[model samples]
Every structure is written in C-alpha cells, then in structure tokens.
Target: MARDRSRRSARGNRLGLVIVGVVLLAAGLAALAVGRGLLGGDLAATPLLGDRTNAVLAQQWVPYVAVAVAFVAGFLALRWLMVQGMNDTVGRLYLARDEAGNVEMPESAARGALEQEVADYPGVRRARARLTESGDHPHLRLALTLEDDADVAGIWRRVRSEAITNLRGALELDQVPAVIRMSMTAPARNPRRSLA
Candidate 1:
C-alpha cells in the first residue's frame, strides 16, 4: 500500500513539473521575441524611452534574461522527471506483525500478518517481519527471539517452511520465500527446578 501511494505521489509531482516547465518555456520564448524587437528592431526607434538609441540598448538585456531563465527552468523540469522515473523502478517495502495469531496458514495479508506468525513460533518471545521484493519474487525476512538452548537450525527450518506455506496460501503466489533469523536468545533455565 505504501509503495502504491509513493508511486502515485511521484507521478503527480512529475506531471506538475512538466506543466510548470511548459508554461515557463512558452513565457520565456514570448518574452525573448518581444525583447528582441524592443531592443534591435524598428520598435527600438520609438521614443518610448525618450531616447530612440538608448531604448534599444536598454532592452537588449531583456532577451538574454528571458532565455537564461527559460533554459534553467526547463532543465530543472527535466531533472525532476528523471527522478520520478527512477522512483517507479524502486517501490516500497515494510516490516509488519501478523494480527490473526495463526502460523499454520499463509499470513500473506501484509507485513503485519507475517510478523504475527513469527511471534507464534514455539521458542520465540518476539518477532519482526520485513517484506522485500527481489526481481519478481517477494522475500520475507523474519527476526525471532528464542531460548538460548533452542535448536536454532531446527526452529529456523520450521519457521521458514511454515511462513512460506502460509504466505503462498494467503497471497496465492508461488515466488514467496522466507528467511528466519534469530535476534536474541533467552538464558537457559535450570531443569532441576521442578524437582526442588
């Protein structure tokens, strides 16, 4: 959703920049043409400035200023358009937590769903899920908190498989992949405590 919003905003900005550029370019061209006539053409001979000779000289600067401003404005507009194009190539991603408390099914609803699934793992105390896009596939990176003595590899494999299954089911997507990472491990408790 965020990605879609960003793309829309960028597109709007590009359109605005284009409109401003066109207006400025047209105004600049008109100003330059008028300035040229005022400075060097028969209009220059008019004593509007009280001095026909000085009138042309005084107006010569107008065309130069108009042309320079137009060029600068056009360049800026082009640059903005380029930036907007680049933005379209790079969309948005996010880290979210699942809310439904279901880990067996694909939590492909959004970032939140995946996060919730991570938290539901047996050894996990907390979990964070990040959604990313690579090529055409959606990749999920999950960071989980676990007990220190937990079987890290076993838990990681289980989480990865479950997440992939759930996401694939929820999103109806085949390219979903998951990576499980441990963020922290709790200290081991004494097994003999129950006997005491």
Candidate 2:
C-alpha cells in the first residue's frame, strides 16, 4: 500500500538522518576541541590521523571505490523514490486454498460486498467502501449516509458485529483496520398546496 510504503520510507530516512547527524555532530565537536586547544597540546604539533606519506589515501583504486559507493547509494535512493511513487491498484484480499488452486478475493469485490451489506441495513441511505492492503494487514474505509432519525448506536453495533466480523473471517485475518464515517441525510420535503 502507498501509506505503508510512505511510512516505511519516512522511517528509513529519519533513521539515516539521525545517524548522519550524530556522526557530523561528533566530528564537528572534535574539530572544535582541537582548534580551541582543549586537547592539552599545541595545535600545530598535534599529529594528524594519517601518516606523513598517507599511502592509503593515495591508492590508485581509491577513486574507483569512491565511485562505486556513490553509484550504490544513488541506486538505493532511486529505488526508494520509485517505490514511494507507485500506483495503489491491483491489491487483493487473502482467501483460503482449495483443492483445485489457491483462492484470492479481489479488493474491489470485497469493498462492494461490504458496501452492499452495510447499505442493506435499515435507515442507511447510502454507503461506500474502499479496501487497501497494507503490510500484513488490510484496511477498510466506509462512508455511510443515514436517515435523520437513524439509531446510530444500534446500527454501529450491528455493523461491527455483522459486517466487520464477517469480513475479517472471510479474509482470514486477525484484524481489518477500518475508518468509518457517518452522515445524516436531510429530511424529505413536500411541496405546499396552492392557496385558492
């Protein structure tokens, strides 16, 4: 699902930033300490990290190694971006296996069934459902329009018991994450008779 991918990508980015930030912070603080004479020695005489000749830094393959690392990092970043910008279609619900072959329920069919079931209840004027499959979980969103005097509590209880419970069972899932919204329709109005 797009939401799942977005969240995962965001978490990865945050973690990477935190690591990079800490490393930079530490390096900067160390440099400041050295510059301010906090290292208990003359700054000019302080031995540098590498040897005088710096043979490792002058290696012939160092440029090639740097190029390889940059290429890998760029490739990974592009992959993450592509995943984030993906289409959310073609998601499905998990169903049981049969003797013939594996059974899978299309998400559109599941959404339609849910909407129909909810709309069939008394006082429900209109209803719609959408299904999105997240990692290891399926999401269900419902929009319901009800009569002005509809029993919100009773209808919601039934919806939870009948629609949500059955959906979870049919999909063989532990839980089906849902977002339900309800609105009341305006009362019907009648035309007034003309005065004589």
Candidate 3:
C-alpha cells in the first residue's frame, strides 16, 4: 500500500512536470516566432514594453518585489528537492514508560530483526525492511529477493504468519500494517545437464 502510494505520487509529479514543460516550450516557441516576425508583422513590430509598463518598472518598490519573488521561488525549489530525497523510515521508537524509566529502541534494530528472519526463509535470497510512521502505530515495508523457482505464495504466507507475527510480538503491538515487494533471480545452471 505504501509502495502504491509512492508510485502514484511519483506518476503525478512526472505528469505535472511534463505538462509544465510542454506549456513552457510552446510559450517559448511562440515568443521566438513573434520576435522573428514569423507569427505576424504587426505583433513583431509592437514594442514589448510600453510607456506605462516602463513607468511601473521605474517604481522604487518594483525591484524589492521582484527580489522577494525570486527568493520565494528559490526556496520552494530547494524544498521540492529535499522532499524528493525524503524516506518514510522513522527513527527511535518510544516503547514503554514507567516510574523507573522509558524504554527506547532504534528503528534499525526492529528492521534488522525482521529482515534477518525473512532472509532465513528457504527460498529468499535477501530481505530488506523499514519501519515507517510513529512507533506507536508503525508500518512495515519489506522487500524480498527470491530464487527463480521459489514458491512466492508460500513465502508470503510464512512471512505474514511467522515473521510478521514475531515482529509484532517483539514490538508488543497488537497490529502492524505491512507491505511486501518481491523479485526473483535467474535459475541456477546445472552442470550435469550442460554436460549431457
């Protein structure tokens, strides 16, 4: 589910970028054509800046406003870039609290344990996991690399029934939402078959 949402968000961003690019490209081409008198003689002959426009530009506040707008645009661009690199993984989890003290655990520890458990499965070649959202209501993201002839359905069942159950017990949480992604590698070559 998390992967689906991420994919959808990425698709939307790409679509928006393409639309903006096309609009800008068209506007640029139209401006170039008009400037070169390809669109029409009258439009090309018309001055880009009239006396009224020049008067507005001459105002003392105009430069300040332009600089402010540039700064805002720059800030937004930087923010967007930062968002692109953001991951859903969460940090330290607050486990329990009492008169003694509060227990805290690194998110990596939970993720590592889950990954190791899943990786130990018969057909899984590798496993990666991330704990997202708050510790109180955590979400799991697991990626598994499997052998070519591995039983995907069986592995999924074991992961849900055994691995996730263990994680939930360790976390002492009633429910833990999870999403799993799997990929298969090429089958191993048989030397005897090759010789035959």
Query: Which has the better TM-score: candidate 1, or candidate 2?
Result: 2
lDDT of 2 by residue, 1-196 (tens): 6567768978998898799999999999998888777886787357675584578868999889989999999999899789768654437765766688767777888778888999999989999887765523678778899999999888899898899998898788878877789999987698487899
Tell me the tens digit of each residue's lDDT in model 3 across 36-136.
99989999999999999999999999999999999999999899889889998889776886899979899989889889889989999999998997867
Q: Which of the numbered candidates is closest to the native, going by highest lDDT? A: 3
Q: Is 1 or 3 the stronger prediction by lDDT? A: 3
- What lDDT does candidate 1 reach at residue 151? 68
- Residue 156 local lDDT, model 3: 99
Q: TM-score of the candidate numbered 1?
A: 0.39
TM-score: model 3 vs. ground truth: 0.87
In candidate 2, what residue range of length 10 has the lowest lDDT sum?
87-96
For every candidate, C-alpha RMSD to the true structure in Å: 15.0, 8.4, 2.7
Best first by lDDT, ranked: 3, 2, 1
Which of the two candidates, 1 or 2, achieves a greater lDDT against the reference? 2
Ranked candidates, highest TM-score first: 3, 2, 1
Estimate the TM-score of every prediction.
0.39, 0.50, 0.87
List the candidate 2 regions with Cα displacement exceeding 4 Å. Answer: 1-90, 96-101, 189-196
